[model samples]
Target: MKAFYDTGELACVALDAVTGPQVFLSGFPLAGSDPEQGQQFLLDHAAEHGHCVLYTPDDSLSLTDLGVLLRSQQVGAARLTRPLFVKEEWLESQYFRDHLPLEGGSD
Candidate 1:
């Protein structure tokens, strides 16, 4: 894990074994990326649709991780794009076009 992080292979690698407390890889809103990690807020607001001051928790984590890895290492990845799961209706809507001028999403 340390070797992966030392090299440009991974942005941040938290190991479970060969060490102390297992390194936990949990998603945090770009907003709540603080020590709290939004755990308290999410628990408080059980009905809220969020994660994330970052907008989409899952997508944000993946995209941000990839971007950080590339920029930090100045390296290229074998795959440039990732598959996403989104609402079919949203993709067809004007909002998707205006906001994300990308190709289509996965089924």
Candidate 2:
């Protein structure tokens, strides 16, 4: 699940690729500071779907905030993977970083 937030309040959560990647969480206030709540929210939506990955904008949270959220999910037994807080450019760079050929290959 990918989450989009503004000033710490969760704005959206995408459940799957088939959902087309733009589902906003409505009708309630979901804050990034509240990791336990975030964990529960994800579990509620994605429990049967297996482990979850939360993607947020870089400006939406700091590393410390994300660490706290990860710790909370671990404590709560939520099957959540690491939260990815990054800008669009960073993601593009990451794609290249992941796919770049190694200098030393089988010769």
Would you list the C-alpha lDDT of every candidate in the order shown?
Answer: 0.26, 0.32
The parts of candidate 2 lying over 4 Å away from their true place are 1-26, 48-107
What local lDDT score does residue 85 receive in model 1, on the 0 to 100 scale?
26
TM-score of each: 0.20, 0.24
Clash counts for all predictions: 0, 0
Residue range 53-97, candidate 1, lDDT tens digits: 223312322222222110011013321222222333333344532
Task: Estimate candidate 2's alpha-carbon lDDT, on a 0 to 1 scale.
Answer: 0.32
User: Where does model 1 exceed 4 Å of error?
Assistant: 1-79, 101-107
Error of 2 at 30 (Å): 3.4
User: Given candidate 2, what's the lDDT at residue 86?
Assistant: 37
Candidate 1 matches the true fold with a TM-score of 0.20
* Residues 15-107, model 2: lDDT tens digits: 321222222333212322255454565555454444334433322221222221222112243322233333333333445223222111120
Clashing pairs in 2: none
